[model samples]
Target: MHAGLNEVTLPAQGWMPTLQSALREATRQQHHRLDHHPLLARLVRPGLQMADYGRALQALYAINAPSERCIADYIAAQGYAFDYAAHQRMPDLLADLAYLSLPVPPLAWAGPRLDSPGELVGCLYVLAGSTLGGRVIFRQLQSVLPVTASAGARFFAGHGEQTMGMWQNFWAFAATICSPAELPAARQSAAALFERILTLLESQSC
Candidate 1:
């Protein structure tokens, strides 16, 4: 355990990997591959309708809602150094569901409770990466869904003008907190999360 970090205290001076580079190295390849997964391809397909939109949101909610809670629990219970405000995304997702008049889906599955700070950090990397991608989807969603940020686009609309700033804030936080030895678990966690999301989407896709 890292001497300063083992107890989950405030940020301390030490060697740490740049969160962005570390995650990019450990997760970007898989992240890129997952983006091209067939289920996701259908999301941005032309002529997508509200029914299709709702289905995608349901699948995503199944994966995101519980998984985020598990991640939050892991962080709160320990010295997991992170930006709590930046990590808060479930409300946006829930608001989107409400806007669409859809019931929040029961949890279909969550990969695992990330118990370790390292593992939780890994999950953060995966979740944070999604928000960046969400911005891209936001534009596509507007073209088809007839929803604005105040309507059904909360999840994809992201932090809006604060999107890049929030990403940078979270990325900077990650680099300082996760140690080199602990990063492998974080990487594996990220891969498992992506896989779980893919599986959930597959189950929901027609």
Candidate 2:
């Protein structure tokens, strides 16, 4: 399997055992408050199959790169600066721990490739949801921990009232992409992504 991607073998029933196991651990370790969030509870069921979620992710994958570029551009255009030292240090720390580096494929951020605001928000939610569990672990690490002084790190912070409205728009956009039947699938996709993120985080921590 390719590192940083889902090339690993899954079950015949399409249940991602590795993903499921990781999430179960993550839930126990970090997202203790997630059970209190109604949205999250509905999204992550214990017996949910991984293939169902993979389908939903496949549906959205085409739009993901452009959406991420949009968010990165938006952050840059807002006059915010990234902490290059922290960014550079993080990969180095991970490398020291023998973790494979994350892929950094070239991203295009200009022209008609730009995503709409709502799409951008939805994408952020997906990204956040996927990585938040792992971030909790990173936040606990003293050496590589994130601080508010870091520019890009602030993106991990939850939205406040003013900025939260934008997230509402994102939620609306996400809603349009799924139906009642597909909601389960979407949740599964989200869980799978989260699990993969946790694996990366764990590798980095080690």
Candidate 3:
């Protein structure tokens, strides 16, 4: 879950790649860990249980709910530099929590330090990336859990038919606003986010 790298910098030419590309490279190792994480590792198992899924959802809600609120507040105070709608996940996460009878985690905790618009855009990378990859997770959960978009699992289902559009819209905004200098911080934020999720889930499921 550690970043494992020192200061990050772009090439001498400073060519700005797509926002998705930068984020993927930044969190590449953490992203790869998805296959080995205790909770996500169960996805490949045929008999994945609701209890395991529930625990994972609970852990995610803990990290995402509060952080989403913080990001929203930051944007509201600073004025919108990116599209907030594409980054919305708290409602869906709460829906899943309610469906599973899990206690709703509060949005009281502080969030990542998004002091700059680019940093805020960086946070969007983490939030949006989860839902982007969540389509696969949604299918996996549907295969085992009795959850549906209505009953549960809306966090994974996300924007449903509009998911791709949401991604495109996010990228359009991010690519323009998230600059090359901010890449390092953005990458750090993304990696820290993954680490935080893994840590919280590990602690909870223990």
Candidate 4:
């Protein structure tokens, strides 16, 4: 879409438009519930703040950054494997996040074989959806970041239909639990958590 930047290409179909539609629909569906849900409100505030951290992450990884290369090299050296398609998804997702102007939290690169991908996925879903403003941000990141077709970047690209489905389920669960009565409290809590997440991300900067 924007000129140049051959390393990353925008989809011919304009993924951002689709992504925006999804976000708008999701937000419309959830706003009423979220406004009333005390916990949900508390969660959203911090989630918004987390967008800043997400941006920081993008800056760290934007092509030509030494730190970004360092991370890729480290992952390779560590022999961390990843699915190619999944890794490719990362740039688009990051791009979507950038488009939305959402805060980009720093990433926590746990090694390839964590005890449980399911558990980690669940946590990521909650943090991204409730704490960081849901799938829109994730999808955006996939769209923008120029992930290489290599083993090291596979972690970002590999989440297939299954992962998206699971994330949707998590959103449903969050919707069920959030209430307007608890929004005030939840907003405060979310702010605190957002700060914590940012602090954690900044620490990872090389």
> Which stretch of 10 consecutive residues in model 4 shows the poorest summed lDDT?
1-10
The lowest-lDDT stretch of 10 consecutive residues in candidate 1 is 1-10
Q: Candidate 3 — which residues are off by over 4 angstroms?
A: 1-18, 81-83, 106-109
Colliding pairs, model 2: 53-189
- Give the residue spans of candidate 2 off by over 4 A: 1-30, 33-125, 128-153, 157-161
Provide the TM-score for each candidate, comma-separated.
0.84, 0.34, 0.83, 0.31
- Using lDDT as the yardstick, the better of models 1 and 2 is 1
**Candidate 1 lDDT tens digits, 47-154:** 878877887787888878877878777666664445465657788888888988999988887556776656777887788878888888888888877899878988
Off by over 4 Å in 4: 1-126, 130-150
Candidate 1 segments whose C-alpha is farther than 4 A from its true place:
1-19, 79-86
lDDT (10s digit) by residue, model 4, range 1-206: 21211222335123334333433443443344533443223322423344343444453333213222333443344333322222233465455455556555444543222122222222223234432333333444444444232322222333444555544443333232223343333343334333433443345433
In order, the Cα lDDT scores of the candidates are 0.73, 0.34, 0.71, 0.36
Give the candidate number with the greatest lDDT: 1
lDDT digits (tens) for residues 17-69 of candidate 3: 55567788878887787647888778547798887787777777766776787
Model 2 C-alpha lDDT per residue in residues 1-206, reported as the tens digit of each score: 11111222232124333323433453453344433333223224443333322222222222234444455675455332321122212222223222222233232232122224333322345554434332432243223332331332332232323234443333433443323444344444444443443443333223
Better of 2 and 4 by lDDT: 4
lDDT of 1: 0.73
Give residue 2's lDDT in candidate 3 (0 to 100). 13
